[model samples]
Target: MQKPLAYRMRPTSIETIVGQQHLVGPGKIIYRMVQAKMLSSMILYGPPGIGKTSIASAIAGSTKYAFRALNAAVNTKKELQIVAEEAKMSGTVILLLDEIHRLDKTKQDFLLPHLESGRIILIGATTENPYINISPAIRSRTQIFELEPLAAADIKTALKRALTDKENGLGHYSVTLTPQALAHYASATNGDLRSALNGLELAVLSTAPDPKTKTITIDLPIAEETLQKKAFSHDADGDAHYDVISAFQKSIRGSDTDAALHYMARLVEAGELVSLMRRLLVIAYEDIGMANLPACARTVNAVLAAEKLGLPEARIPLADAVIELCLSPKSNSGISAIDAALTDVQTGHSGEIPKNLKDAHYKGAEALGRGVDYQYPHNFKGDFVVQQYLPNNLKKKQYYEPKTNGKYEQAFKIQYEKLKKLLK
Candidate 1:
């Protein structure tokens, strides 16, 4: 039996490689490095199926070095040392460590001494931000080449190659891809080449039973059926992190209790940590502002309870906070008011400070009538002195507009009324 399309279609040379032109294009840094045989210990940081491993293989094949591949997920420090010793015997060894970010600081430190000696040209791959996951010492020694997701056009080209190239491709199948079908496959894979090829292969194998007909057609619906379920909840990196959180925040903002709950469930079901959920809860206050002050308090309480209670049981406090935030009366611009005031001050929109509110220690300032008209709120009727506190240009600018239904609204209304009567 023939090998799978993903395996069969692996590029043997740099010329046959798909996508990632930014790294391997004519006159690119990687191209120049490969050509000069001046390759450094580097990290290939990117999403899956973007030719990281393939590039490493091509580099090994093109150069005069022995290639050694190991997965950090399965390999141990002892195994790494063994490989380093082997590289020392061999003139130059290109050690390709897949998912290198999985190594903890101690395990990663094992490679530093070997890398410093130039025994092995370390080529590592990771789906995460190296700055966050990789050890600082190891990271500083290796140059990082960021690989991007394959474009739709690149995926299309790959599909065409799989259909035509006879050596390892599915040329014998006589499959034809419609533009719509190609787009469906591309969109479904989200620039993952292996996934795209797997999806395409599945579509062809399932749909085309007879190769004698010499024609096969694939559509979005068929593609959807073949790729029935979304493999994982989140995309590579944290691309979906902000997206999921945004949806959660918006659901609460819109006061859709059910929607809020649903989004909360999605995050939890997707294996998002309770701590991240709590962090988002805190942001709900700053973003939601006085529109729902209870939201902020509830969020804080939920975080504290979650920390104390832990998971499963802790999920309850999180859900309660979400519901409370959704139901609470909303306001706007509480935090923004302070921000605007500060911006005004920085931009020179500020005028003279009220004498009573200013420093009282300045010599002769009090004698010059600075505090002559100042009225202390504590000494006035109802503790309500309606004095001008804003700079001259912003005196008429009302920053804190209270909502009509919340506790703050009631308090603000009462205070405003008493202050108006007292000042008059």
Candidate 2:
């Protein structure tokens, strides 16, 4: 049976690999390792279709070592045993384990001895951040290399090469790809070579060849239809999920409405409503606090509506909240002030509360000097009075440094400065 176009086009050697020049280029680490025949186990981390597996396949082909592919989350311990046995027989073998972050203790334990003996060179591939997702046991045994996305020019080059490749590509097919079509394939996928190549194949096979020339002419429209939506994989547990969430928050914090909406769209596509709502609430208080008090309340209302509505419809309120938050004035003084106070409390710097501020409701409270000499502010003119609220050790400490980010917070700054001067 014929494999998929993507699988068939896998490069056999490092020289043919489309991207990842940092590692696969001449004089690079992988190139040097293959040239010296000094191969070691390593982990290749990056997004899908960006050549993590290609690097592993190329290394195996270059070194003439046995190559085997397995998914850590899908393959069983028996499968791992087979690869290890082959290593024992063949002197050495290269095992490309995908989603290595999901490797369990049993399979990992079995592979550890073989890895230690240098019999099995493990090439772990993942879309997750290894430092956060993978266990230390497997991580310590392997070197980690991150793959970068293929450039548009690099992808176009690969696509052109595929068109002429008869054995594994569409060389024999009577296909005419226009310049506009080529540009769509290169740019529409957002630097994904696999999507572009395979999309080309689909367009070629699906389109009808003209009766006269017997040529399948792929135009811009066909290219767009073939790849209507770019490949999206947002595993909630993966690094991509966190990366998008981080971007969504930072864009809002930086007051970039468009960028915030873009990331929110990705999260919506992944159906991460719970995470989205929770983060919006946090951003409201942490980033948009005090500056726009109404914005904080509106964000809460929006989150509640989103949680109650759920999905498709839920995105309506969320979109409204995201736009408002992105445009809202940003201030971190509230969170910053609290964190500073927290740091002091955590470091054991919390001295005793002032006697005047201590509880005095109990019958014997006054005997302990609680609430003694307490000047009631309400009984004074203007209903304002100066008193030491903080403990003696922190009497001079000022944590809340208000900013005039918005009119509401500006008023706060005025009042705060007035009180500060009075206390001094």
Best by TM-score: 2
Clashes of each: 2, 0
TM-scores, one per candidate: 0.55, 0.62
Q: Candidate 1 on 388-410: residue-level lDDT in tens?
A: 77666776765554556577656
Q: Which candidate is the best by lDDT?
A: 2
Q: List per-prediction Cα lDDT, in the order shown.
A: 0.74, 0.87
Local error of candidate 1 at 60, Å? 2.0
RMSD of each: 11.8, 13.1
Residue pairs of candidate 1 with colliding backbone atoms: 291-330, 291-331
> 1-424 in candidate 2: lDDT tens per residue?
7776878888999899998999999999999999999998999998778888888999999999999999999999999999998998999999999999999999999999999999999999998999999989888998889998777678778888888899999999978888767766765565578888889989988999999999999877787679864223322222455678899999999999999999999877755676688789999999999999899999999998987888789999999999999999889999999999999999998999999989899999999999997899999889989888889999999999899889989999999999998876
